[model samples]
Target: MMAVDKGARCLVLNGATLGATGSGVLALFSGGHPLSSAALEGLSATAGMASLCRVLLEQAGWEDGPGRIVAVTGPGSFTGLRATLALAQGLALGYSASLCGVTLGQAYRAREGWSEAYCITRARRDRLFMERPDGTVWAGPSGAIALPARAFVVGNGVSMLDLPQHETLIRADCTSPDPRDIYRAACHADDRPSLQPLYIDAPEARLPSQGLRPSPV
Candidate 1:
């Protein structure tokens, strides 16, 4: 678990997990002191995850105050991502703190010994959300438009697609996204977005009918 050091100055929050196929949550605090390592935990949308995170920081002994707080803006859960955004926005607003973020692919880059990496998340059956190593340029909605094939598709989302591995496609098989990947990206951004989530598919539920139709005689 990340803890407050003798003289830390910045705090980083990991919201990029909102894009993973399953629930992934992480947050860290670092300053000019020693090390900030928080015990990462995964939780479904079941209950209290958000409140729990705040409580964790407090228990770890970090003063939540003015400074930089990083958030991830991306292709992720509509509800979870929105909730994280709401929390980050509220924190920034309340503390008058600055905000920034790292995206899914960029987070992967934080891992070691992986150069020429390609990170992706589910966009739609006909498309995929991706980022270049530069971590700034937007590639394609590709499968639906243009842009070359990819080398490796990170995250369990690829399993959901079961795409072929001919000239393109490779499943990541990684369990959890690396925290260092997030820290690196957060370092690059300091004004995180007010994300409006990117859902790969439309909502499954349907609304009630305006009224029932008459039956034939």
Candidate 2:
């Protein structure tokens, strides 16, 4: 039988952009070892995440005190980010578990073999969220962000970059934050990471109102 850690277990959550053809994954980790992970593809993240949490808890066999919960805080689909953050926050509060938010950039940084890492994730159409090798973050149209020569690029936005040498980029299996990396981020996070979503643009519902209004001549 696997030994239980008594409130030392961790639950990590990650999701891809809505309609992005990737899976939402949740894992149960004890110590540094992953105990069980559950994933569902092509399901509505808003609904799917809640179901995933139950599956993960059952898979891990939680019986006692609450455990830690880690969630990825955007730079991806607005809908996906909202759903994930809400689910994680709810679970944390319900279980009285420690909660932390790991930015998508942080997940990429946790990966090995990339000193000059340029983390990028899809934003709105033709736009992206990019973390430069120097650690500066910017979000704008694809052509707006400049890339240094030979910087190792990763993330879902890489495909949309249309770079000359696409062969040089390090594309991940999935565009979403890797669950393994999310776990690492939770472990090494300073205190608690912010739970705020990293939305680069205001909601479309407010866009029309944001336009400059005509003034009296």
In lDDT terms, which candidate is top?
2
Residues 98-148 of candidate 2 have per-residue lDDT tens digits of: 888877777777777654568887777788888775556788988777776
Model 1, position 26, has a per-residue lDDT of: 45
lDDT of 1 by residue, 10-34 (tens): 5455443433244555455556332
Ten contiguous residues minimizing lDDT sum, candidate 2: 15-24
lDDT against the true structure, each candidate: 0.53, 0.72
Off by over 4 Å in 2: 163-174, 206-217
Error of 2 at 42 (Å): 4.3
TM-score of 2: 0.83
